[model samples]
Target: MEKYIEIRGTNLFVKYLNPDSRKPTIIFLHDSLGCTKLWRDFPEKLGNATGCNYLVYDRLGYGKSDPMPTNPRPSNYLEIEADILNDLLIKLQIDSAILFGHSDGGSIALITASKYPSRIKGILCEAAHIFVEEITLRGIYEAKELYKNSNLAERLEKYHGNKVDILFNAWVETWTTSDFRNWNIEHFLHNISCPVLFIQGEADEYGTMAQVEKTVAQVKGKAEKYIIPNVGHTPHKEIPDQVLDRTIDFILQLAH
Candidate 1:
Protein backbone atom coordinates (compact mmCIF):
# COMPACT_ATOMS: atom_id res chain seq x y z
CA MET A 1 0.00 0.00 0.00
CA GLU A 2 1.15 3.53 -0.77
CA LYS A 3 0.39 6.41 1.54
CA TYR A 4 1.39 9.90 2.52
CA ILE A 5 2.57 10.25 6.10
CA GLU A 6 3.19 13.46 7.99
CA ILE A 7 6.52 13.52 9.79
CA ARG A 8 7.59 16.62 11.60
CA GLY A 9 4.85 18.53 9.79
CA THR A 10 6.23 17.42 6.43
CA ASN A 11 4.37 15.11 4.09
CA LEU A 12 6.49 12.09 3.27
CA PHE A 13 5.71 9.20 0.93
CA VAL A 14 5.61 5.66 2.33
CA LYS A 15 5.02 2.28 0.76
CA TYR A 16 4.10 -0.80 2.73
CA LEU A 17 4.29 -4.43 1.64
CA ASN A 18 2.53 -7.22 3.53
CA PRO A 19 1.62 -4.66 6.16
CA ASP A 20 -0.86 -6.89 7.97
CA SER A 21 1.60 -9.68 8.61
CA ARG A 22 2.30 -10.64 12.19
CA LYS A 23 6.06 -10.58 11.58
CA PRO A 24 8.16 -7.65 12.64
CA THR A 25 8.40 -4.82 10.13
CA ILE A 26 11.57 -4.30 8.12
CA ILE A 27 12.04 -0.62 7.48
CA PHE A 28 14.25 0.32 4.50
CA LEU A 29 16.08 3.64 4.30
CA HIS A 30 17.34 4.83 0.94
CA ASP A 31 20.74 6.21 -0.08
CA SER A 32 21.67 9.82 -0.83
CA LEU A 33 19.81 10.00 -4.16
CA GLY A 34 17.43 7.17 -3.31
CA CYS A 35 13.74 7.33 -2.56
CA THR A 36 11.01 4.78 -1.92
CA LYS A 37 10.56 4.36 -5.65
CA LEU A 38 14.21 3.50 -6.15
CA TRP A 39 13.71 0.42 -4.00
CA ARG A 40 11.58 -0.98 -6.84
CA ASP A 41 10.54 -4.60 -6.21
CA PHE A 42 13.06 -5.51 -3.55
CA PRO A 43 10.68 -4.84 -0.68
CA GLU A 44 7.91 -6.90 -2.25
CA LYS A 45 10.28 -9.77 -2.90
CA LEU A 46 11.68 -9.68 0.59
CA GLY A 47 8.24 -9.40 2.16
CA ASN A 48 6.87 -12.33 0.18
CA ALA A 49 9.87 -14.54 0.88
CA THR A 50 10.13 -13.83 4.59
CA GLY A 51 6.50 -13.08 5.36
CA CYS A 52 7.74 -9.95 7.08
CA ASN A 53 6.07 -6.58 6.72
CA TYR A 54 8.19 -4.01 4.89
CA LEU A 55 8.19 -0.25 5.09
CA VAL A 56 9.99 2.08 2.68
CA TYR A 57 9.80 5.83 3.03
CA ASP A 58 11.26 8.93 1.47
CA ARG A 59 13.04 11.28 3.83
CA LEU A 60 12.39 14.98 3.54
CA GLY A 61 14.10 16.61 0.50
CA TYR A 62 14.06 13.40 -1.54
CA GLY A 63 11.35 11.47 -3.37
CA LYS A 64 7.86 12.87 -2.78
CA SER A 65 8.66 14.53 0.49
CA ASP A 66 9.17 18.24 1.08
CA PRO A 67 12.45 19.84 0.02
CA MET A 68 15.29 20.81 2.31
CA PRO A 69 16.12 24.47 2.68
CA THR A 70 18.79 25.65 0.23
CA ASN A 71 21.45 26.05 2.86
CA PRO A 72 24.34 23.99 4.13
CA ARG A 73 23.29 21.12 6.40
CA PRO A 74 24.86 20.45 9.76
CA SER A 75 27.27 17.55 10.16
CA ASN A 76 24.86 15.93 12.59
CA TYR A 77 22.03 15.79 10.07
CA LEU A 78 22.00 11.99 10.15
CA GLU A 79 21.46 12.15 13.91
CA ILE A 80 18.59 14.50 13.31
CA GLU A 81 17.21 12.09 10.72
CA ALA A 82 17.35 9.32 13.30
CA ASP A 83 15.26 11.40 15.66
CA ILE A 84 12.72 12.05 12.92
CA LEU A 85 12.57 8.34 12.21
CA ASN A 86 11.85 7.67 15.86
CA ASP A 87 8.90 10.05 15.74
CA LEU A 88 7.59 8.42 12.58
CA LEU A 89 7.69 4.97 14.11
CA ILE A 90 6.01 6.13 17.31
CA LYS A 91 3.28 7.96 15.46
CA LEU A 92 2.58 4.93 13.29
CA GLN A 93 2.43 2.57 16.27
CA ILE A 94 5.47 0.56 15.22
CA ASP A 95 6.69 -0.64 18.58
CA SER A 96 9.94 -1.93 17.15
CA ALA A 97 11.30 -3.19 13.84
CA ILE A 98 14.41 -4.32 12.02
CA LEU A 99 16.13 -1.51 10.17
CA PHE A 100 17.67 -2.06 6.73
CA GLY A 101 19.60 0.96 5.52
CA HIS A 102 21.82 1.61 2.50
CA SER A 103 24.53 4.26 2.27
CA ASP A 104 23.21 7.38 3.93
CA GLY A 105 20.23 5.36 5.06
CA GLY A 106 22.56 2.92 6.78
CA SER A 107 24.23 5.73 8.69
CA ILE A 108 20.80 6.94 9.75
CA ALA A 109 19.99 3.45 11.01
CA LEU A 110 23.17 3.37 13.08
CA ILE A 111 22.36 6.75 14.59
CA THR A 112 18.80 5.65 15.22
CA ALA A 113 19.90 2.51 17.00
CA SER A 114 22.37 4.44 19.11
CA LYS A 115 19.88 7.15 20.05
CA TYR A 116 16.81 4.93 20.42
CA PRO A 117 18.16 1.47 21.20
CA SER A 118 14.83 0.06 22.33
CA ARG A 119 13.08 0.99 19.11
CA ILE A 120 15.15 -1.22 16.82
CA LYS A 121 15.07 -4.99 16.99
CA GLY A 122 18.01 -5.43 14.60
CA ILE A 123 19.87 -3.51 11.92
CA LEU A 124 21.46 -4.26 8.54
CA CYS A 125 23.79 -1.72 6.96
CA GLU A 126 25.06 -1.71 3.37
CA ALA A 127 27.92 0.55 2.36
CA ALA A 128 27.21 2.61 5.47
CA HIS A 129 29.94 5.07 6.26
CA ILE A 130 30.90 5.64 9.90
CA PHE A 131 33.28 8.44 8.92
CA VAL A 132 34.21 10.40 5.87
CA GLU A 133 36.75 8.66 3.64
CA GLU A 134 39.04 9.93 0.91
CA ILE A 135 37.49 7.34 -1.40
CA THR A 136 34.04 8.62 -0.48
CA LEU A 137 35.02 12.17 -1.40
CA ARG A 138 36.39 10.99 -4.73
CA GLY A 139 33.23 9.00 -5.52
CA ILE A 140 31.00 11.98 -4.87
CA TYR A 141 33.20 14.12 -7.06
CA GLU A 142 32.94 11.67 -9.94
CA ALA A 143 29.19 11.37 -9.47
CA LYS A 144 28.84 15.13 -9.64
CA GLU A 145 30.70 15.14 -12.90
CA LEU A 146 28.45 12.41 -14.25
CA TYR A 147 25.33 14.31 -13.30
CA LYS A 148 26.61 17.47 -14.87
CA ASN A 149 27.50 15.84 -18.20
CA SER A 150 25.09 12.97 -18.58
CA ASN A 151 21.37 12.09 -18.62
CA LEU A 152 21.46 11.24 -14.94
CA ALA A 153 19.28 14.18 -14.05
CA GLU A 154 16.71 13.25 -16.66
CA ARG A 155 16.60 9.69 -15.37
CA LEU A 156 16.33 10.85 -11.80
CA GLU A 157 13.49 13.19 -12.77
CA LYS A 158 11.08 10.27 -12.86
CA TYR A 159 11.40 9.98 -9.10
CA HIS A 160 12.36 13.47 -7.87
CA GLY A 161 10.40 15.73 -10.24
CA ASN A 162 11.49 19.36 -9.87
CA LYS A 163 13.35 18.60 -6.65
CA VAL A 164 16.10 16.69 -8.49
CA ASP A 165 18.51 19.60 -8.46
CA ILE A 166 17.91 20.34 -4.81
CA LEU A 167 18.23 16.67 -3.91
CA PHE A 168 21.42 16.14 -5.90
CA ASN A 169 23.15 19.25 -4.58
CA ALA A 170 22.10 18.51 -1.02
CA TRP A 171 24.09 15.29 -1.17
CA VAL A 172 27.07 16.29 -3.31
CA GLU A 173 27.62 19.88 -2.26
CA THR A 174 27.38 19.06 1.42
CA TRP A 175 29.60 16.00 1.41
CA THR A 176 32.32 17.53 -0.77
CA THR A 177 32.53 20.70 1.29
CA SER A 178 35.50 20.86 3.71
CA ASP A 179 33.30 21.72 6.67
CA PHE A 180 31.71 18.25 6.56
CA ARG A 181 34.88 16.28 5.80
CA ASN A 182 35.46 15.26 9.40
CA TRP A 183 31.92 13.94 9.89
CA ASN A 184 31.84 10.69 11.81
CA ILE A 185 29.31 8.61 13.78
CA GLU A 186 31.62 6.35 15.82
CA HIS A 187 30.53 8.05 19.02
CA PHE A 188 27.01 6.67 18.61
CA LEU A 189 27.97 3.06 17.77
CA HIS A 190 28.65 2.02 21.35
CA ASN A 191 25.17 3.04 22.36
CA ILE A 192 23.51 0.48 20.08
CA SER A 193 22.40 -2.64 21.91
CA CYS A 194 20.84 -4.64 19.10
CA PRO A 195 22.49 -7.11 16.77
CA VAL A 196 23.82 -5.63 13.53
CA LEU A 197 24.79 -6.97 10.11
CA PHE A 198 27.11 -4.96 7.92
CA ILE A 199 27.28 -5.63 4.18
CA GLN A 200 29.76 -4.10 1.79
CA GLY A 201 31.08 -4.52 -1.72
CA GLU A 202 34.73 -5.30 -2.13
CA ALA A 203 34.91 -3.23 -5.29
CA ASP A 204 32.99 -0.34 -3.87
CA GLU A 205 34.42 2.96 -4.93
CA TYR A 206 32.69 4.98 -2.25
CA GLY A 207 33.91 3.20 0.89
CA THR A 208 36.40 0.66 2.11
CA MET A 209 36.37 -2.31 4.48
CA ALA A 210 37.31 0.12 7.23
CA GLN A 211 33.83 1.53 7.10
CA VAL A 212 32.36 -1.88 7.83
CA GLU A 213 35.07 -3.04 10.22
CA LYS A 214 35.00 0.19 12.19
CA THR A 215 31.27 -0.11 12.74
CA VAL A 216 31.44 -3.77 13.68
CA ALA A 217 34.27 -3.14 16.12
CA GLN A 218 32.39 -0.38 17.91
CA VAL A 219 28.91 -1.89 18.08
CA LYS A 220 28.01 -2.98 21.60
CA GLY A 221 26.07 -6.08 20.54
CA LYS A 222 26.84 -8.99 18.26
CA ALA A 223 27.83 -7.92 14.75
CA GLU A 224 28.36 -9.82 11.47
CA LYS A 225 29.74 -8.72 8.14
CA TYR A 226 29.84 -9.95 4.55
CA ILE A 227 32.03 -8.43 1.88
CA ILE A 228 30.68 -9.38 -1.52
CA PRO A 229 33.30 -9.91 -4.22
CA ASN A 230 33.21 -8.13 -7.58
CA VAL A 231 30.45 -5.78 -6.53
CA GLY A 232 30.24 -2.03 -6.13
CA HIS A 233 28.47 0.28 -3.69
CA THR A 234 24.94 -1.15 -3.74
CA PRO A 235 25.01 -4.86 -3.06
CA HIS A 236 21.28 -5.35 -2.71
CA LYS A 237 20.80 -4.06 -6.22
CA GLU A 238 23.90 -5.61 -7.74
CA ILE A 239 23.64 -9.02 -6.12
CA PRO A 240 20.08 -9.48 -4.97
CA ASP A 241 20.19 -13.24 -4.57
CA GLN A 242 23.15 -13.20 -2.20
CA VAL A 243 21.80 -10.24 -0.30
CA LEU A 244 18.34 -11.79 0.07
CA ASP A 245 19.69 -15.16 1.09
CA ARG A 246 22.05 -13.66 3.64
CA THR A 247 19.49 -11.20 4.95
CA ILE A 248 16.76 -13.79 5.25
CA ASP A 249 19.06 -16.12 7.16
CA PHE A 250 20.19 -13.35 9.48
CA ILE A 251 16.71 -11.98 10.17
CA LEU A 252 15.15 -15.43 10.67
CA GLN A 253 17.86 -16.34 13.15
CA LEU A 254 16.91 -13.28 15.18
CA ALA A 255 13.48 -14.86 15.69
CA HIS A 256 14.90 -17.75 17.66
Candidate 2:
Protein backbone atom coordinates (compact mmCIF):
# COMPACT_ATOMS: atom_id res chain seq x y z
CA MET A 1 0.00 0.00 0.00
CA GLU A 2 1.19 3.49 -0.91
CA LYS A 3 0.16 6.68 0.80
CA TYR A 4 1.28 9.99 2.20
CA ILE A 5 1.91 9.87 5.91
CA GLU A 6 2.58 12.94 8.01
CA ILE A 7 5.98 12.40 9.60
CA ARG A 8 7.43 15.09 11.78
CA GLY A 9 4.85 17.50 10.38
CA THR A 10 5.97 16.75 6.83
CA ASN A 11 3.93 14.77 4.33
CA LEU A 12 6.19 11.87 3.36
CA PHE A 13 5.45 9.36 0.62
CA VAL A 14 5.47 5.82 1.98
CA LYS A 15 4.87 2.35 0.59
CA TYR A 16 4.29 -0.78 2.60
CA LEU A 17 4.37 -4.33 1.27
CA ASN A 18 3.43 -7.78 2.59
CA PRO A 19 2.10 -6.56 5.91
CA ASP A 20 2.59 -9.55 8.12
CA SER A 21 2.31 -8.36 11.68
CA ARG A 22 3.86 -11.60 12.86
CA LYS A 23 7.17 -10.98 11.04
CA PRO A 24 9.83 -8.32 11.35
CA THR A 25 9.67 -5.45 8.88
CA ILE A 26 12.56 -4.70 6.55
CA ILE A 27 12.66 -0.98 5.97
CA PHE A 28 14.45 0.06 2.79
CA LEU A 29 16.10 3.49 2.84
CA HIS A 30 17.24 4.98 -0.46
CA ASP A 31 20.40 6.86 -1.40
CA SER A 32 20.78 10.66 -1.37
CA LEU A 33 18.96 11.27 -4.65
CA GLY A 34 16.58 8.32 -4.37
CA CYS A 35 13.00 7.89 -3.21
CA THR A 36 10.23 5.28 -2.94
CA LYS A 37 10.07 4.72 -6.67
CA LEU A 38 13.81 4.52 -7.06
CA TRP A 39 13.88 1.41 -4.89
CA ARG A 40 11.91 -0.31 -7.67
CA ASP A 41 10.97 -3.97 -6.97
CA PHE A 42 13.83 -4.78 -4.63
CA PRO A 43 11.68 -4.31 -1.55
CA GLU A 44 8.92 -6.51 -2.94
CA LYS A 45 11.38 -9.17 -4.05
CA LEU A 46 13.08 -9.17 -0.70
CA GLY A 47 9.79 -9.13 1.17
CA ASN A 48 8.57 -12.16 -0.73
CA ALA A 49 11.85 -14.01 -0.42
CA THR A 50 11.96 -13.55 3.35
CA GLY A 51 8.18 -13.52 3.93
CA CYS A 52 8.66 -10.28 5.86
CA ASN A 53 6.93 -6.94 5.68
CA TYR A 54 8.82 -4.09 3.97
CA LEU A 55 8.50 -0.34 3.99
CA VAL A 56 9.92 2.29 1.62
CA TYR A 57 9.55 6.02 1.86
CA ASP A 58 10.72 9.24 0.28
CA ARG A 59 12.59 11.60 2.58
CA LEU A 60 11.23 15.11 3.15
CA GLY A 61 13.00 16.74 0.23
CA TYR A 62 12.82 13.97 -2.34
CA GLY A 63 10.27 12.27 -4.57
CA LYS A 64 6.59 12.72 -3.70
CA SER A 65 7.29 13.87 -0.17
CA ASP A 66 7.31 17.48 0.92
CA PRO A 67 10.29 19.58 -0.10
CA MET A 68 12.86 20.51 2.49
CA PRO A 69 11.89 23.58 4.50
CA THR A 70 15.29 25.17 3.93
CA ASN A 71 18.28 24.99 1.64
CA PRO A 72 21.99 24.63 2.52
CA ARG A 73 21.06 21.96 5.03
CA PRO A 74 22.64 21.89 8.46
CA SER A 75 25.71 19.71 9.03
CA ASN A 76 23.74 17.42 11.31
CA TYR A 77 21.14 16.65 8.68
CA LEU A 78 21.71 12.90 8.74
CA GLU A 79 21.35 12.86 12.52
CA ILE A 80 18.06 14.71 12.22
CA GLU A 81 16.96 12.17 9.65
CA ALA A 82 17.73 9.39 12.07
CA ASP A 83 15.55 11.04 14.70
CA ILE A 84 12.78 11.31 12.15
CA LEU A 85 13.06 7.60 11.37
CA ASN A 86 12.74 6.73 15.04
CA ASP A 87 9.63 8.88 15.31
CA LEU A 88 8.26 7.27 12.18
CA LEU A 89 8.63 3.80 13.66
CA ILE A 90 6.93 4.91 16.87
CA LYS A 91 4.05 6.48 14.97
CA LEU A 92 3.64 3.36 12.85
CA GLN A 93 3.84 1.08 15.89
CA ILE A 94 6.59 -1.00 14.34
CA ASP A 95 8.17 -2.96 17.15
CA SER A 96 10.76 -4.79 15.04
CA ALA A 97 12.60 -3.43 12.02
CA ILE A 98 15.65 -4.50 10.03
CA LEU A 99 17.02 -1.52 8.18
CA PHE A 100 18.43 -1.87 4.65
CA GLY A 101 20.01 1.46 3.86
CA HIS A 102 22.23 2.66 1.00
CA SER A 103 24.66 5.57 0.93
CA ASP A 104 23.14 8.46 2.88
CA GLY A 105 20.37 6.13 3.95
CA GLY A 106 22.97 3.72 5.30
CA SER A 107 24.45 6.43 7.52
CA ILE A 108 20.97 7.27 8.75
CA ALA A 109 20.36 3.63 9.64
CA LEU A 110 23.56 3.48 11.66
CA ILE A 111 22.56 6.63 13.52
CA THR A 112 19.05 5.35 14.16
CA ALA A 113 20.33 2.02 15.43
CA SER A 114 22.67 3.79 17.83
CA LYS A 115 20.13 6.26 19.20
CA TYR A 116 17.09 3.95 19.30
CA PRO A 117 18.25 0.40 19.79
CA SER A 118 15.00 -1.11 21.03
CA ARG A 119 13.07 -1.28 17.79
CA ILE A 120 15.94 -2.08 15.44
CA LYS A 121 16.56 -5.81 15.04
CA GLY A 122 19.58 -5.44 12.77
CA ILE A 123 21.11 -3.25 10.09
CA LEU A 124 22.43 -3.84 6.55
CA CYS A 125 24.41 -0.79 5.48
CA GLU A 126 25.66 -0.49 1.89
CA ALA A 127 28.30 2.10 1.08
CA ALA A 128 27.67 3.95 4.35
CA HIS A 129 30.11 6.61 5.40
CA ILE A 130 31.01 7.29 9.02
CA PHE A 131 33.27 10.20 8.15
CA VAL A 132 33.91 12.40 5.18
CA GLU A 133 36.87 11.37 3.01
CA GLU A 134 38.77 13.13 0.26
CA ILE A 135 37.57 10.48 -2.17
CA THR A 136 33.97 11.22 -1.23
CA LEU A 137 34.47 14.87 -2.06
CA ARG A 138 36.02 13.94 -5.37
CA GLY A 139 33.02 11.77 -6.26
CA ILE A 140 30.62 14.57 -5.39
CA TYR A 141 32.64 16.96 -7.54
CA GLU A 142 32.48 14.52 -10.43
CA ALA A 143 28.75 14.13 -9.92
CA LYS A 144 28.32 17.89 -10.01
CA GLU A 145 30.13 17.96 -13.30
CA LEU A 146 27.99 15.11 -14.61
CA TYR A 147 24.84 16.92 -13.55
CA LYS A 148 25.91 19.96 -15.51
CA ASN A 149 27.16 18.20 -18.63
CA SER A 150 25.28 14.94 -18.94
CA ASN A 151 21.68 13.71 -18.69
CA LEU A 152 22.00 12.98 -14.99
CA ALA A 153 19.70 15.82 -14.09
CA GLU A 154 17.14 14.81 -16.70
CA ARG A 155 17.18 11.22 -15.51
CA LEU A 156 16.71 12.28 -11.90
CA GLU A 157 13.87 14.51 -12.95
CA LYS A 158 11.90 11.47 -14.07
CA TYR A 159 11.83 10.31 -10.45
CA HIS A 160 11.92 13.60 -8.49
CA GLY A 161 9.88 15.71 -10.90
CA ASN A 162 10.01 19.48 -10.31
CA LYS A 163 11.74 18.94 -6.96
CA VAL A 164 14.75 17.48 -8.79
CA ASP A 165 16.82 20.62 -8.62
CA ILE A 166 16.36 21.10 -4.89
CA LEU A 167 17.22 17.51 -4.11
CA PHE A 168 20.26 17.49 -6.38
CA ASN A 169 21.58 20.79 -5.13
CA ALA A 170 20.98 19.80 -1.54
CA TRP A 171 23.19 16.75 -1.95
CA VAL A 172 25.98 18.48 -3.87
CA GLU A 173 26.06 21.71 -1.86
CA THR A 174 25.90 20.08 1.57
CA TRP A 175 28.61 17.53 0.89
CA THR A 176 30.93 20.06 -0.74
CA THR A 177 30.82 22.49 2.17
CA SER A 178 34.04 22.77 4.19
CA ASP A 179 32.24 22.38 7.51
CA PHE A 180 30.52 19.24 6.32
CA ARG A 181 33.94 17.77 5.49
CA ASN A 182 34.44 17.09 9.17
CA TRP A 183 30.94 15.70 9.58
CA ASN A 184 31.44 12.30 11.10
CA ILE A 185 29.20 9.86 12.99
CA GLU A 186 31.88 7.47 14.22
CA HIS A 187 31.09 8.45 17.80
CA PHE A 188 27.68 6.83 17.44
CA LEU A 189 29.20 3.52 16.35
CA HIS A 190 30.05 2.32 19.83
CA ASN A 191 26.42 2.80 20.83
CA ILE A 192 25.05 0.41 18.20
CA SER A 193 24.57 -2.89 19.98
CA CYS A 194 22.42 -4.65 17.42
CA PRO A 195 23.97 -6.93 14.81
CA VAL A 196 25.11 -5.11 11.67
CA LEU A 197 26.00 -6.30 8.15
CA PHE A 198 28.23 -3.90 6.26
CA ILE A 199 28.24 -4.26 2.49
CA GLN A 200 30.27 -2.22 0.04
CA GLY A 201 31.79 -2.42 -3.41
CA GLU A 202 35.51 -2.75 -3.84
CA ALA A 203 35.39 -0.22 -6.64
CA ASP A 204 33.13 2.25 -4.88
CA GLU A 205 34.00 5.70 -6.06
CA TYR A 206 32.64 7.63 -3.11
CA GLY A 207 34.27 5.77 -0.20
CA THR A 208 37.09 3.36 0.48
CA MET A 209 37.35 -0.02 2.21
CA ALA A 210 37.99 1.95 5.39
CA GLN A 211 34.26 2.59 5.58
CA VAL A 212 33.42 -1.08 5.97
CA GLU A 213 36.52 -1.90 7.97
CA LYS A 214 36.06 0.83 10.58
CA THR A 215 32.34 0.14 10.82
CA VAL A 216 32.98 -3.55 11.38
CA ALA A 217 35.67 -2.74 13.92
CA GLN A 218 33.77 -0.12 15.94
CA VAL A 219 30.19 -1.36 16.32
CA LYS A 220 29.56 -2.97 19.69
CA GLY A 221 27.45 -5.79 18.28
CA LYS A 222 28.14 -8.73 15.99
CA ALA A 223 29.37 -7.21 12.77
CA GLU A 224 30.17 -8.71 9.37
CA LYS A 225 31.42 -7.33 6.08
CA TYR A 226 30.69 -8.28 2.45
CA ILE A 227 33.03 -6.64 -0.02
CA ILE A 228 31.85 -7.29 -3.55
CA PRO A 229 34.55 -7.44 -6.20
CA ASN A 230 34.31 -5.24 -9.30
CA VAL A 231 31.23 -3.46 -7.98
CA GLY A 232 30.83 0.26 -7.51
CA HIS A 233 28.95 2.21 -4.84
CA THR A 234 25.72 0.26 -5.24
CA PRO A 235 26.33 -3.42 -4.68
CA HIS A 236 22.69 -4.45 -4.53
CA LYS A 237 21.87 -2.85 -7.84
CA GLU A 238 25.04 -4.15 -9.41
CA ILE A 239 24.58 -7.74 -8.24
CA PRO A 240 21.11 -8.32 -6.89
CA ASP A 241 21.35 -12.10 -6.67
CA GLN A 242 24.48 -12.04 -4.53
CA VAL A 243 23.11 -9.30 -2.31
CA LEU A 244 19.74 -11.03 -2.07
CA ASP A 245 21.30 -14.33 -1.11
CA ARG A 246 23.53 -12.77 1.52
CA THR A 247 20.81 -10.53 2.89
CA ILE A 248 18.38 -13.40 3.15
CA ASP A 249 20.92 -15.42 5.08
CA PHE A 250 21.55 -12.49 7.43
CA ILE A 251 17.87 -11.77 8.08
CA LEU A 252 17.04 -15.45 8.49
CA GLN A 253 19.78 -15.85 11.04
CA LEU A 254 18.45 -12.84 12.92
CA ALA A 255 14.94 -14.26 12.85
CA HIS A 256 16.12 -17.40 14.59
Best candidate, TM-score: 2
Give candidate 1 regions above 4 Å deviation: 18-21
| Alpha-carbon lDDT of model 1 | 0.90
**lDDT tens digits by residue: candidate 1, 68-171:** 87746777888899999999889778866899999999999999998888879999999999999999999999999999999999999999899999889888
lDDT of each: 0.90, 0.92
| lDDT of prediction 2 | 0.92
Task: Look at candidate 2 and tell me the lDDT of residue 234.
Answer: 86
- Span of 10 residues, lowest total lDDT, candidate 2: 13-22
Best by lDDT: 2
Across 1-256, the per-residue lDDT of candidate 2 in tens digits comes to 8888998678999898755798999999999988888877888888898889999999998999998866689999999999999888998889999999999999999999999999999999999999999999999999999999999999998898888888888899999998898898999999999999999999999999999999999999999999989999988888999999999999989888
